[model samples]
Target: MPYPDKFNDSYSETKADAEKLVMRANGREGLLTCCIRPSSIFGPGDKLMVPSLVAAARAGKSKYIIGDGNNYYDFTYVENVAYGHVCAEKTLSSEDGAKIAAGKTYFITNMEPIKFWEFMSLILEGLGYERPSVKIPVSVMMPVAHVVEWTYQKFAKYGMKVPQLTPSRIRLLSCNRTFSCSRAKEQLGYEPLVSLKDGVKRTVESYSHLQAQNHRSISKASIFLGNGNLAKTVLWEDAKQTVTVLLLLAVIYYHLFTCGYTFITAMAKLLSLTALFLFIHGMLPSNLYSPLLSLFICCIYLLSND
Candidate 1:
């Protein structure tokens, strides 16, 4: 089945897709549907959120806590979420399936809501790192996010798809989006096996082992501090060069497909294209993007009305 355009947003889309799938399986003799919506999942070998935070702390990038850092979130251990899914699958039957049918969503959190900053601090402390001290207000961050997103979009048309301080990310940092896992507990009889503290201990232990291996590998070689710094600098420079090449390619592609004639005219067209990109980039700030994008869309409506 095709996903609706409105499902582009994560919250809406994920729930919408689950509901659609469940509805399709309804009334089938052997089919049963169970939707387990897990909260912010963290465990060993996680690459996206938890590991990224750990890396950022190690690299001295997690010292700045954005917004009030007091926002609460329901974080679930990966094993717990998996356990809930397994329980649902085992219990879901055609006779009992209707009890867990379409539009019935279960929150699969650990039933513990922790403040964002506290969670970060716990992870850092577990890893033998200092907790963050700097706190930036959401109001001050909104404009900076706007500019960063604007810069990315403007250059992206020129082939620079650089990271932007998007509005959604800002909201994630600032907004309180805690969910209750009562439904999962009641229906699937799901319970989280690992506590947050135990999870952090396990994660830190694994990271320490990996770091020790890295140190051993480095010690085996004749590598010095200067050599490490030089290698890092070279890698950073190479990445910048790659982005520049991609930007040039984007400009060339835009000119080729859009029928812009002569160098001056083509550059002018590119400027207009870049402006549109900048507008989109500006809309990328996690705090401002949602409202700004809606406004941009509204303006399009007003203009079309004429």
Candidate 2:
């Protein structure tokens, strides 16, 4: 599926086979051609999926799960994907295989279907980032994501980065997208070379710099050490996280009291604000140290908005 600001995601497979028509036309010229489609490929060397997730987590934009967190997806580990390729290559070279598997497409995966958000949580927590707990139902987020995508499309020439909350991306997140690897298993004897857990661990370990604890510890000294102790110890234990929660509360306070906005209207507005924040936060360049700190600054900026 194509995410906002990217025809690449939607067009990748076609692009990968851009010369397929030529190959097909010149086929039986002793050409054995096949395509291996791997789902959500991730592992130590992954350049897209894992990096993007880490960026969102560090930016505090991964707090909201865009659905019920029940969507099932197949994530293919890099090693497993490579193994599938080897199987395909060997199969294509065999005596009985040349005519049979050529000009075919095979879906390769770890073959373990996991709830999408659970998979996300495992990766996040493994890297020491907090797992997402808030559920933003697709109904609330879809329209917002669409607007982000459309806006990016319109303003890309003016330096808008491709938005991360594209409607296509919401669809990808909020839907079940598991693929069966039975064909590859039988035809090519392809088996996953690594389990999903190990793959996630390896991927998380590969990105040592993004480790969540790398953030400097926030000052924990509270003004009222005894009376404020309860909220401090139980709810706002982490000073930085507490600051964000306070910001959220402040926004709610202003809308409910000062602004005189209707309760429902205030809530709708809050939800919209949350979505916009996630969109901008997720689009931030996952650079070294800069955007990470900028994310906390943005959270503090939310107080000014209130």
- Model 2 error, position 229 (Å): 30
Scored by Cα lDDT, where does model 1 land? 0.66
lDDT of each: 0.66, 0.75
- Candidate maximizing TM-score: 2
Q: Which ten residues in a row have the lowest lDDT in candidate 1?
A: 216-225
Give candidate 2's error at residue 300 in angstroms. Answer: 30
lDDT of 2 by residue, 1-306 (tens): 222344435655565556356347435667677777799888887787777887776445777889898889999998998999899889889968756667777899999999999998988898888798999989999899888988988777655767778777888889998988888888888999899888888988998877778864334443235324344644566554354456556667766787878899999998886665444434544353345545756875676577
| Residue ranges of candidate 2 with Cα displaced over 4 Å | 1-9, 12-28, 217-306
Error of 1 at 92 (Å): 0.9
Model 1 Cα shift for residue 30 (angstroms): 3.7
